[model samples]
Structures are given as C-alpha cells and as structure tokens.
Target chain A: MSQFLQFLFSGLTEGAVYAMVALGFTIIYNASDVVNFAQGEFVMLGGMVTFFANAAGIPLPLAALIAILVAVVAGLALNRFAIEPARGASVVNLIIITIGASIFIKGLAQLVFDKRFHRFPAFSGDDPIRVLDATILPQSLWVLFGACAIFSGLWLFFARTLVGKAITAVAANRLAAELVGISAKRMMALSFALSAAIGAIAGILITPISPTSVEVGTLLALKGFAGAMLGGMGNPLGAVAGGLIVGIVEKMSAGYVSTNYKDAVAFIIIILTLLVLPTGLFGKARVDRV
Target chain B: MLAREEASGPAWLSVEGLASHYGRIQALRDVALTIAKGEIVSLVGANGAGKTTLLRTISGVQPASAGRIVFEGEDITTLAATARVSRGIAQVPEGRQIFGPLSVADNLRMGAYLRKDGEIAVDMDRIYALFPILAGFRARPGGSLSGGQQQMLALGRALMSRPRLLLLDEPSMGLAPVIVDQIFAAIVRLKSEGMTIFLVEQNAFAALSIADRGYALETGSVILSGNARDLLADEKVKEAYLGI
Candidate 1:
C-alpha cells in the first residue's frame, strides 16, 4: 500500500506537468485548427532561459519572468512569421509548418544555450512531505498548485469574460467570428501567447525535479500530445485528467514492470487511444460546418 | 427598358468598378452599384451568378482585385473585415452562419462584441422582442435552432451591432414560404425604421418586390440595374430570374 502511494504521488506530480502541456496544446488547437508541434520547445525555453539568466546573476524570480516573456515573444513571432503567412494553407501544411518551427526553435536553443543539461534550485527548500507512509517533494506540491490555479483561472476566463467567449467563437466559426468584428488573427496570436506562457510555467515548475536540456522538449511534446489525445482534444478537464492518467500509467509501469517500458507508455497509449477512442475520452461527435 | 440611376449625391455606400478573383477564376467583374440611406436595395441573380461574391466583397471577406468600396465617402476597399464591422457595416452571411455551439443569447452578444456603449443590454432586449421565439431559446445552443429560427437569429445578431448598413446574403434560402414571408416582413419593417439594407437573393421576385432599387447580375457582372419595379417587369429579368 505504501509502495502504491509513493508511485501515485510521483505519478501525480509528473501528470501535472503533462497536463499543463496538454492544456497549452488545447488552447492553440482551439483557436487555430493547427496543432502546434512546437509547444514542448516553449517549456524548454522556460527552463533553459531562466537557468542561464540566473547564472548571469539575475534573481531567480526575475529570471523566470524574463524566460516567460521570451517564450511569449517566440510564440508571437512564430504566429506572425510562419502561421499568418500561410493563412489559408491546408491543415496538414500548417502542421508541417509548426513542426518546422519546433525544429527551428530547437536548433536556435542548442546554439544559444549549449549542449549541457540544466537545472535550478526549487522555489522552496528541498524537503520531503510524508503522507500515509509515502514521502513527496515540496516542489511537487508547487507544480500541482500552479496547474490547478491556471486551469481554474482559464475556466473562469472562458465562462465569464467576453474575450474568452470570443476565443470560443473563433474556434467555432472563423467566418462568423470575423463578421462580428472578432479578429481571428488577433485571437490566434493571443492563443499562441497564452499557450507559450503556460508551457514556460510548466517548465519552470518541473526543472528542479527532471532537469532540462535542449532536446528535453521532443519527448515532452510527444507525451503532452498523447495526453491531449487521451483527454479529447478540445476540452479542458479532459486534458488534465488525460495527463494524470498518462503519468500514473507511466509511473506504475516503471515501478511494477520496468523503467525501460516507462518511456514507451505514452506512445502506446496514444496509439491504442487512437485505434479505440479516436474522439478521445471527452470529445463529442462534431458535425463540422463547411 | 433599364434606366441606371447613377450615384447622384453622397450615397450611403458605393462600389465602383469592383472586381474579384478566386485564384484565376473571376467571381465579380466590374460590379458598380450604390445604395442610399434608409432604403432597400436588392441584387438578384440565378445560381451561377456572382450575387454571393459581391455581397462578400462589400463585407470585406472576399478581396476586390480592382476598384473602390466607399462607405460614407471613406474608401474601405482595402480595410479588413473586422475594421469594416467597426465602421458600422454588418453582414448576415449566406447560410445564417450562427456559431453552432454558442447559446442563442451568446450568439446575439457576439454581434455587439465591438460596442462600448451601455445600450447593448437595451438593444438585446429589442431584438428579443423583434423575434420572440429567440427569447425562449436564449439558453439553447444556436445550432439546435430550426432553419427559420437561425435566420431570425442571424438577422437579430446583425442588428445587435446597431449597424448603419446591413448586408444580407440569401436569408430566404432553404426556408419554408411562411418563414420567408416573416423574414421579408422583418426586412421591410427594418426599412420603415430607417435602416439601410443591401439584400442579395436568388428569390428575385420577393427581393425586387420589397426593394426600392435593384441590380441584375449574370456571369459575374452587372448586366442591368434600375428601379426595382422596372427590372421586375423587364423581359430579360422576368424570364431569367423571376421565372415569370
């Protein structure tokens, strides 16, 4: 039982990070029909930029803030320079463009930040919290709290605010949105910025535990995509739940089975989910309007 | 006989020598027309005609490859669609393209998205009164509405913007005759209340019967335009569009 509890806590912590990335994917995917494959790089940028900035003598908090802003600029630049220019391109073409962007960002990071892995001290002192005979890191709690706060904040934004509704509107019908004076382009930019910021926050939260290298984003992005697929692509709660399921499954497999199978868990889940529940756990049968 | 009534004074909206292309295929060619304040102007055509394309160009969704769109004398030919909405131009697109997942009330709220005034609530109430069925379905998703109700919702949505110029494209399409009458009556009522309307329809007789002026389009160009009554009685229009 204690062993199970330990794995659960570990799973939940990792799940929180994956859930954040999945949520980021959901936002960009909703606003623009394009799945931004570059989402993981935003997380890497958050960790790497903050670590280097801190090494340059900046305070940790300020470094994290600067890193977030840098990710945001990168997001906006990706939209303006790549996505907007290919405005009417097919969905497949746009996905390719995002993949290109991911590759480009990864290359740039490799050059600017070097090939070494990076980490920073946790926000709070490194201490373990015991619950039911299982010990969990204090930083895990922060990661969980940060994710819940973001999810709740976004839920309120979408349900209560006009800007939030506008995002929903754009996701529903681009032509109708434009007819009502909602700038779809601006909304797309906002989606990119918001998703990028969220990705950076997840990176900041996770770095103390996992550490980050330039290539860390590739696996993270793939796992995040798997989580989003499991959750149902467009729904928020699905993303979080899907991510948690993924992390738990991975940790459980590693504990009981082998660490060798841990990394393949997400990919296998993605494939099985696609073959079985293509619309995801939370998605509906959508009748697309032409 | 067609008597083209050229723009005599400062028109409410004017399109001069407008042309548009979808790739290499020209969809609208040298289409010049004008609408005055507080009147109904209809553009009538057959299935292959460029009526929808022209309406899209005026609404700034489809780009014009040549010519100018002047609204109250400001050249809006190159303005973005959102900017055109901000400048008091609203379009009820073909097929009553309501945001399917949005509630009926939310759909109307989308129309007033750019409004900063406190009158939004007031205007919303007025629309509910105008289309009483919508008031009952305020909490329902817009896609669940019937065809006629969706058309009413689209019109109400456009009106929520308090637009000076309303561009409607084929509102009567795919609706029952009774619903068509209700929509046309609403259009007439709006004209009586001093709204400038540019209506495009494949149902030529109904359109021209309510319009003060009419333009006949064929194969992507304006072939004849004159007083609605004259065009309604003309041999070419009657045979081609009115099915007389």
Candidate 2:
C-alpha cells in the first residue's frame, strides 16, 4: 500500500507538469487552429533561462520572471514572424511549419545554453513531507498547487472577463469576431503569450524535482501531445485530466513493470485511444452544418 | 415621381466607382451609390449580382481593387474591418454568423465589444425587449436556436453596438414569411428611431416596399437607381426581379 501511495505521489507531481504543457497546447490550438509544436520549448526556456540568470547573481523569483518574459517574447515572435506569414496555408503545411519552428528553437537553445542538464533549488525548501506512510517532496505540493491555480485562473478568465470572451469569440468565428470589432490578430498574439507564460510556470515549478535540458522539450512535448489527445483537444479541463492520467499510467507501469518499457506506455495508450475513440474521452465530435 | 423629394440631409455614406475582384473574376464593377441620414436604402439584386460583395466592401471585409468608400464624409476605404465596425458601421453578415458555442446573452455582449461605456447593460436590456424570445433563451447556446431566432439574435447583436449605419445582408434569407415580417417590422422601427440602414436583398419586392430609395444591381453593375416606388413600378424591374 505504501509503495502504491509513493508511486501515486510521484505520478501526481509529474501529472501537474504535463497538465500545464497540455494547457499550453489547448490555448494556442483553440485560438488559431494551429497545433504549435514549439510549446515544449517554452518550458525548457523557463528552466534554463532562470538557471542561467540565477547563475549571473539574479534572485530566483526575478530570474523566473525574466524567463517567463523571454518565453513570451519568443512566442510572440513565433506567431508574428512564422505563423502569421503562413496564414491561409493548408493544415498540413501549418503543422510542418510549427515542427520546423520547434526544431529551429531547439537548435538555438542548445547553441546558447549548452547541452548540459541543470537543476535549481526548490521555491519553499527540500523538506519531504509524510503522507499515509509515504514520503513526498514539498516541491510536489508546489507543483500540484501551481497547476490547480493556473487551471482555476484560466477558467475564471474565460468565463468572466471580456477580453477572455473576445479570445473565445475569435476562436469560435473569426469573421464574426472582426465584425464585432474583436481583432483576431491581436487575440492570436495574446493566446501565444498566455500559453508561453503557463508553460514557463510549469518549468519553474518542476525544475527542482526534474532537471531540465535543451533536449527535454522534445520528449515533454510528445507526452503533452499524448495527454491533449487523450483529453479532448481545445478543452482545458480535459487536458488536465488527460495529463494526470498519462502521468499515473506512466509511473505505475514503471513501478510495477520493467522501467525499460515505461516510456513506451504513453505512446501505447495514445495509439489505443486513437483507435478506439478518435474524439477522445471528453472531446465532442464536431458537426459542420451548411 | 418620388425621386424629386430631396433628402433632408447630406449623404451619410457614399460609394464611388467601387470595383472588387476575386482573383481574375471581378465581383463588383464601378458600383456607386449613397444613403442619406435616417434613410432605409435597399440594394436589390439577384444571386451573383454582387450585392453581398458590395456590402462586404463597405464593411471593409473584402478589399476594393478600385474606387473609394466614404462614411460620414470621411474617406474610410482603407480601414480594416474591425476599424470600420468601431467607426459605427455594423453589419449583420450573410448567413447569420453567431458564435455557436457561446450563450445567447454572451453573443449579445460580444456585439458591444468595442464599447467601454456604462450603457452596455442598458443597451442589452433594450435588445432583450426588442426580441422578447431572446430574453427567454439568454442561457441557450446560439447554435441551438432556430433559424428565425438566430436571425433575430444577429440583428439584435448588431444593434447592441449602437451603430449609426447598420448594414444588413439578406436578413430575411431562409426564414419563414412570418419571421421575415417580424424582421422587416424591426428594421422599420429602427429607421423610425433615426438609424441609417443599408439593406441588401435578393427578395426585391419585400426590400423595395420598405425602402425610401432603391438601386437595381445586375452583373456587378448598378443598372438603375431612383425612388423605391419608381423602381417598384418599372416594367424592366417587374419582369426581371418581381416576376410580375
């Protein structure tokens, strides 16, 4: 029972990070029908930029803030220079563009930050707390709480705020949104910035527990995409649930089965889910009317 | 004969030598027209006659390859669609493109997106009163509403912006005669309240009956322009549009 609890705790911590990444995917995809493959790079930027800034004698909080700002600028640049120019392109062309952008960003990060895994101290401390005969890192609590807070904040933004609703209105119908004076271009930029900020928060929260490297973005992005696919695409709540499920499944498989095959678990589930339920657990099937 | 009754004020909107193209295909060709303040000016044309394209150009959705659009005596031919909307030109677009997933009340709120004043709530109440059925379905998703109700919602949404110039494109399309009557009645009410309306329709008779002035467009060119009553009685318009 203690072993199960231990795996569950680790799973939940990892799940929180995945949830944040999936959320980033959801926001950009909803706003601009484009699945941004560069989402994972924002997380890497958050961790690495903060680490390098802290090494340069900046305070931890300030470093994290600078890191988030950098990621936001990167996101805006990506949208303006890369995505916007390719507007009206086919969906496959857009996907290829994003993947190309992800590769370019990964290469840039490696050149600037070097190819070394780096870690930072936790926000609160290194204390381990006991829960039902299982020991869990205090940083795990921060990760879980951060994920919950982001989800709640996003929910309120989308539900209650005028700017948030305008973003949603653009997502629903771009032409209609423009007719009502909501600028779709501005909304697209805002979504990228918001998504980058969320991903940066995840990176900052999880870096102490899991060391980050420039190449970490590729694997993290794959797992995050899996979670988004498992949940309904474009549904924020579903993305969270999907991320948690992916994390728990991965940890449980590693704990009970051979650790060698643990990485394979997420992909296996993704394939099976796609075969059995293409729309996903919470995804609604789109109905196009004439 | 009614063409001799001069408009009481200067033209509120004027389009001159407007031409638009869809690649090599010209959608509008040298189309020119005007609307006086508080007048209901209807543009009657058949399908593919460029009525929708002209309205879209006026709203800044489609680019005009040649010619200029002036709203309120200001040259606004180069403005963006959102800018045109903010400048008080609101369009009830063809096909009633309401945000499907948003609630009816939220759809109404989106119409007032550019307004920052405190009168939003007051205007919202007025819209609800204008379309009483919408008040009952405030919580319902916009897509779930029937076609007629969605049309009403679209009109109400446009009105929520408190636009000085309302551009309506085929509001009576695909609706029952009763619902069409209701929409026309609402348009008449808005005109009485001093709104300048530019209406485009393939339903020529219904549009001309309510319009003070009317224009006949054919194959992307304005073939006839005069008083609504004169155009309604013209033998050519009768044979071509009214099936008289």
Candidate 3:
C-alpha cells in the first residue's frame, strides 16, 4: 500500500511538470495556429539559468524570477524574428522554423552555460512529508501547488480579463476578432510571453529533483507537445489533464514495466489517442464553412 | 433624393477612393461613398461584388490597397481595427460572427470592451430591451441561438460600442422571412434613434426598403448611386437585383 501511495505521489509530481509544459504549448497554439517546436527551450532556460544563478550566489526565488523574465523575452524574440516574418508560410515551413529555433536556443544555452548538468535548491526546505504510510517530498507539493495556481491564474485571466478574452477571440476567428477590434499581433506576442513564463516556472520548480542540462529541453518539449495533443491542441483544461495522464502513465510504465521504455509508452499512447480521437478528448470537431 | 433632402444633416462619415484587396485579388476598386448623421446608406450587390469587402475595409479588417477612409472627418484609413472601434467605428461582420462558446451576455459585453465609461451597465439593459429573447437567453452559449437571433446578437454587440458609424455586412443572409423583418425593424429603430449606418446586403429589396441612400456595386465598382427609392425603381437595378 505504501508502495502504491509512493507511486501515486511521484506520478502526480511528474504530472505537474508535464502540465506546465502542456500549458505552454496550449497558449502558443491558441495565439498562433503553429505548434511551436521550441517551447521546450523555455523550460530548459528556466532550470539551467536558475541553477547557475543560484550557484553564483543569487537567491533561489530571485534567480527563478530573472530566469522567467529571460524566457519571456526569448519567447517574444522567437515570435518576432522567427514566426512573424514567416507568417502565412506553409505548415511545413512553420514546423521547420520552430525546430530551427529550438536548435538555435539549445546551442545558445550550451555557449552561455556550460554543458555540465546542474541542480538548484528547492524553494522551501527539502523535508519529506509522510502521509498515511506514504512519504512525499516537500518539493513535490510545491510543484503540484504551482501547477494548480498557474492553471487557476490562467483561468481567471481568460474568463474575467479583457486581454485574455481577446486572446480567446483571436483563437476562435482571427478575421472576426480583428473586425471586433482585437489586435491579433499583440495577442500573439502576449501568448508567447505567457507560454514561456509558465515553462520557466516548471523548470525552476522541478530542477531540484531532475537536474538541468542544455539537451533536457528537447525531450520535455516532445512530452509536453504530446500531452497538449492528448488534451486537444487549443484546450487549456485538456492540456493540464493530458499532462497529468501522461506523467502518471510514464511513471507506472517505468515502475511496473521497463524503465528504459518509459518514454516509448508516452509516444505509443499519443499515437493511439491520435488514431482514436483526432480532435482530442476535450476538443470539439471544428467544421469548415463553405 | 433622400440624401439631398438630408444634406443639411451633419456629415458623419465619408469614404474617399477606398481600395482593398484579398491577396492578389483587388476586391474593392477606388470606392467613394458617404453617410450623414442619422442616415442609413446601403451597399447592394451580388456575391463577390465587394459589398462585404467595402464593410471590411471601413472596419479595417482588410487593409486598404490605396486611398483613404474618413470617419467624422478624421482620416482613419490607416488605423487598426481595434483603434477604430475605440474611435467609435464598429462593424457587424458577414455571417454574424458571434463567439460560439461564450455566453450571450459575455458576447454582448465583449462588444463594449473598449468603453471606459460607467454607462456600460446601462447599455447592457438597453441591448436586453432591444432583443428580449437575448435577455432571456443571456446565460446560454451564443452558438445555441438560431441564425436570426445570432444576427440580433451581432447587431447588439455593435450597438454596445455606441458607434458613430456602424458598418453591417449581410445581416439578412440565411434567415427566415419573419426574422429578416425583425432585423429590419431593429435597424429602423436604430435609424429613428439617429445612428449613422453603412449597410451591406445582397437582399437589395429589403435593404433598399429602409435605406435613405443606396450604392449598387458590380465586380468592384459602384455602378449606380441614388436615393434608395429611385434605385429600387431603376430599370437595370430592377432586372439585376430587385427581382422586379
């Protein structure tokens, strides 16, 4: 029973990270129809930069803050230099641009911060809290809480705030949204900023358990994209649900199944989900008007 | 002509040589038109005759290929759509583009998004009064509304902006006759309340019935311009658009 509880807690913690990454995918996809391949770089930036900053004597929270700001600026730059100039290009071209951006960012990270793996101290103390025969790290709770808080914050931003609704409108119909007086470009920029910030938060929170490296972003981006696809590309709630599901599945496969094939399990589930529910579980099938 | 009779009525908006394009296709070709304060100016045409394009250009959704757009004597040709909305220019786009997932009330509130005044609440009540069915279905998703109700919602949204110039594109398409009458009645009410309007419609008879002035467009140019009553009576317009 304790083993089962341990697995559940660990699964949830990993899910929280995936959820944040999935959210990043959701926001960028909502603002621009392009599925940004470079989204994982934001996560890497958060973890790697925060780790180095802490090692260089900066406080943990402040380091995380600076890392998040940097990620946001980088996201904006990605949109401006990489996405905007190539606007209305073919889907294949868009995919190549984002993949190029991911590679470029990874190369830059390697130059800026050495290829050596690094870890950061958790926000709070590193004590494990025991619950009903199961033990869970305090950092796990931090990650879980952070994911929930970010989701709630995003919910309020979209439902209650004007700017958020403008983003929603743009996602729904760009031409109509423009006719109704919303700037599609500004909303696109805002999406990138929001997406990168969320990714950075995930990286900062999880770096204590899983150390950061330049190449770490590629896998996270793939997993997050898979999670977002599982949840439905544009559905925010679906992204969170998808992330948690992917995390739990991966952990179970690693525990009960072979640890080496854990990543393979995620991809298999993605393929199955795509085959069965093409629009995703939460996404409605959108029909084109003639 | 009604426009001549209403000449002393203040000039509320003007479009001078307004041109627009869709990719390589020039959809609007050097169009010039005007709407006086408290007047309804209708642009009538067939599908692809640039009726929708003209409304889109005025609202700044489609960029002007060349020439200028003036609203209340201000050159607004280069302004972004949102900027124009804040400047009191609003449009009800073709096909009644209501936010499908949003609640009816929220969709209406979105129309007044740029309004900083405290009277937004009052405007909500006014919109509700104008479309009682919408008030009743305020909590329902906008997509649940029928085609005509959606049109009403779109018009209500534009009115929420309290716009000096309201541009409507094809409000009567795909609606039942009774609903079309209801929409036309709402337009008449708006006109009676002194709102300047630029209406685009393929339903020339219905559009000309309420319009003070009319411009008949073909391909991308205005082929005829006159009082709505005269255009409704013209031989060419009768054979082509009015179905007489």
Candidate 4:
C-alpha cells in the first residue's frame, strides 16, 4: 500500500510538469492553429537561465522571475519571427519552422551555457514529508501546488475576464472575433507569451528533480506534445487531465512492467486514444459546416 | 481607394463600386449602397446574390477588389476588420458564429471587449433583459443553445459593442417561424430605439416588412431600390426574391 502511495505521489509530481507543458500547447494551438514544436525550449530556457542566474549570485526567486520574463520575450520573438511570417503557410511548413526553432534554441543554449546538468535548491526546505507511510520530497509539493495555481489562474482568466474571452473568441472564430473588434494579432502574441510563461514555471519547479541540460527539451517536448494530444489539442482542461493521466500511466508502467520502457506507455496510450476517440476525453468533435 | 473617399459623403455608411472575389470568381461587382443615420435599410436577395459579400467587404473581412467603404463619413476601406469594428461597425455574421465552448455570458462579453467602460455587467444585464431566453441560459455553453437561441445570442453579442451601425446577415436562416417572429420583433424594437441597421436577408418579404427602405441585389449589383413598401409591391422583386 505504501509502495502504491509512493508511486501515486511521484506520478502526480511528474504529471504536473506535463500538465503545464500541455497547457502551454493548448494556448498556442487555440490562438494559432500551428502546433508549436519549439514549446519545449521554453522549459529549457527556464531551467538553464535560472541555473546561470543563481550561479551568478542572484537569489532563487529573482532568478526564477528573470527566467520567466526571458521566456516570455523569447516566446514573443518566436511568434513574431517564425510563426507570423509563415502565416497561411501549410501545416507541414509550420511544423518545420517550430522544429527548426527548437533546434536553433538548443544550439544557442549550448553556446550560452555549459553542457553539464545543473540543479537549483528546492524552493522550500528539502525535508521529506510522510503522508500515509509514503515519503515525498518538499519540492514535489511545490511543483504540485504550482501546477494547481496555474490551472486555476488560467480557468479564471478564460472564464471570467474580458480579454480572456476575446482570446476564446479568437480561438473559436478569428474572423468573428475581428468583426467584434478583438485584435487577433495581439491575441496571438499574448497566447505565445502565456504559453511560454507556463512552460517556464514548469521548468523552474522541476529543475531540482530533473536537472537542466541543453538537450533536455527534446524528450520533454515530445512527452508534453503527446499529453496535449491525449487531452485534445486546444483544450486547457484536457491538457491538465491528459498530463496527469500520462504521468500516472508512466509511473505505474515503470513500477509494474519495465522501467526501461516507461516512456513507451505514454505513446501507446496516445495511439489508443487517437484510434478510439480522436477528439479526446474532454474534447468535443468539431462539427463541419456544410 | 479613391472611390471610397467619395463614398464618405455625409452618410452613416456608404459604398461605391465595391467589388470582392473568391479567387477568380467575383462575388460582388460594383455594388453601391448607403444607409442614412437612424434608418433601417434591408438588402434582399436570393442565395448567391452577393449580399453576404457586400456586408463582409463593408466590415473589412473580405477586402474589396475595387471601390471604397466609408463609415460615419470616414474612409475605412483600407482598415482591417477589427479596426473597422472599433470604429462602430459590428456584424452578426451568417451561421451565428458564437464561440461554442464559451458560456453565453462570456460570448456576450467578447462583443464588448474593445469597450473601456467599467459597466460591462450593466450592459450584460441589458442584453439579458432584451433576450430573456439568453439570460436564462447565460451559464450554458453557446454550442448548447438551439439555432434560434444562437441567433439571439449573436445579435445580443453585436449589441454589446454599442455599435453605431449593426450589419446583420441572414438572421432568419434556419429558424422556425416562431423564432423568426421573435427575431424580427427584436429588430423592430431596436429600430424604435433609433439604431441604424443594415440588414441582409434571403427572406425578402419578411425583411421588406421591417425595413424602411429596401434594395434588390442580383449578381452583386442593385437592380432596383425604393421604399420598402414599394419594393414589396414590385412584380419583379415578388417573382425573384419573395417566392410569390
């Protein structure tokens, strides 16, 4: 029973990261139809830049704040330089552009920071807290709390706020949003900023456990993309649910099956979900107008 | 562009020599139309008669291939759709393009997104009062609403913008007769409130009954235009558009 509890906690912590990344994917996908492959770079940037900033003697909170700011700006640049220029381009072209961006950021990270893995101290104390005979690290709690806070924030932003509704409007029908005076261009930029900020938060929270490296983004991006697909693209709630599902599945698979093939579990679930219910758990199938 | 400048002549909205196309197929050709302040003008036509194209071009969604669009005595032919919207032109597009995932209340708020006023809640209450059905379903996702209710939501959303000119496209499409009566009654109420409206409808007889004036558009050009009562009584209009 303790073993099961341990796996559940561990799964939730990892799932939080995927949930944040999936939320990031949802924002960009809603604002622009392009599925951004470079989304993982935001995570890398958050971890690496904060690591360097902390090394330079900055406080951890300040370093995290700076990392988030940098990620937002970088995300805006990605939208402006890469996404906007390729507007109306084929989906395959968008895929290439974002993938190319991911590679470019990875290369830039190697040039700017050392290739060695880096870690930051946990936000709170490093004491292990026991719940029902399951010991969990303090940092894991921080990650879980951060994920919950972000999800709540996004829910309020989309459901209650006017600007958020405009974003929702653009997501639903760009032409209609524009006809009602919502600037689709500005909304697009804001989506990228929001997406990157969410990714940065995920990175900052997980850096202690996961460590930071230039190449870390590739696998994280893939998993995050998978989670988003599993939840249904363009759905924020689905992103969170999908992230938790993937995380728990991977944890259970590693515990009961084979640790080496843990990653395969997420992919298998995604394939099955797509084959069975293509729109996903919380996603609605879009009705085609005749 | 030059034609747009001339169309800015002391009218709520004016268009001259307006042309639009979908690829090589021209949807609107040299279409000229105008609406006076506080007047309800209806553009009645059959499907494929370019009524929608004309409204879209005026709102800046479908750019004009040639000619000018002036709103409130200013040239807006070159502005983007959002910009035009901020200048007091709001459109309730055909098929009622409400955000399906959003709540009915949130959808209405999206209409007032550009407004800096703090009384959004007040405006929302006003919309609810106008369409009690929407108020009852304000918490429901827009997609959950029936077709007639969605049209009401769309029109209510457009009203949230406090637009000086409201352009409605085919508001009667796919609606039951009872709902159509409600929608038409709402238009009458709006007109009584001194709203300037440009209405496009395939239901020519119903539209003509509510309009102060009416224009007959065929293949993107106005073949006949006169007082609404006169157009309703015309033999050609009755045969071509009214299904008489």
Which numbered prediction scores highest in lDDT against the true structure?
1
User: What range of 10 consecutive residues in model 1 chain B has the weakest lDDT sum?
Assistant: B1-10
* Model 4 regions more than 4 Å off: A89-93, A284-290, B1-11
Clashing residue pairs in candidate 2 (N, C-alpha, C atoms within 3 angstroms)? none
User: Candidate 1: misplaced stretches above 4 Å?
Assistant: A287-290, B1-11
Q: How far does residue A163 in candidate 4 sit from its true spot (Å)?
A: 1.6
Poorest lDDT segment (10 consecutive residues) of candidate 2 chain A: A281-290
Top candidate on DockQ is: 2
| True contact recovery of candidate 3 | 0.40
Candidate 3 segments whose C-alpha is farther than 4 A from its true place: A286-290, B1-11
**lDDT per residue (tens digit) for residues A1-290 in model 2:** 99999999999899889889999999999999998888889998999999999989999999999999999999999999999999999878988898898899889998898899999999889989999889999999999999999999999999899899889999989988989889999999999999999988899899999999998887788788888889988889889999898898899999999789877877986897799977777999654232
Residues A135-158 of candidate 1: C-alpha lDDT, one tens digit per residue: 999999999999999999999988
Model 2, B1-244: lDDT tens digits are 0011224455489999999999999999999999988899999989999998999899888899999999877999999989898888899999999888888999999999998888888888888888899999999888888989999999988887878889999999999999999999999998887788899999999999999999999999999999999999999999999999
Report chain B TM per candidate: 0.95, 0.95, 0.95, 0.94
Instruction: Rank the candidate models, highest lDDT first.
Output: 1, 2, 4, 3
lDDT minimum window of 10 residues, candidate 4 chain A: A281-290
Off by over 4 Å in 2: A286-290, B1-11
User: TM-score for model 1?
Assistant: 0.96
TM-score of each: 0.96, 0.97, 0.95, 0.91
User: Which one wins by lDDT: 2 or 4?
Assistant: 2
All DockQ scores? 0.53, 0.60, 0.43, 0.49
Q: Fnat of candidate 1, please?
A: 0.61
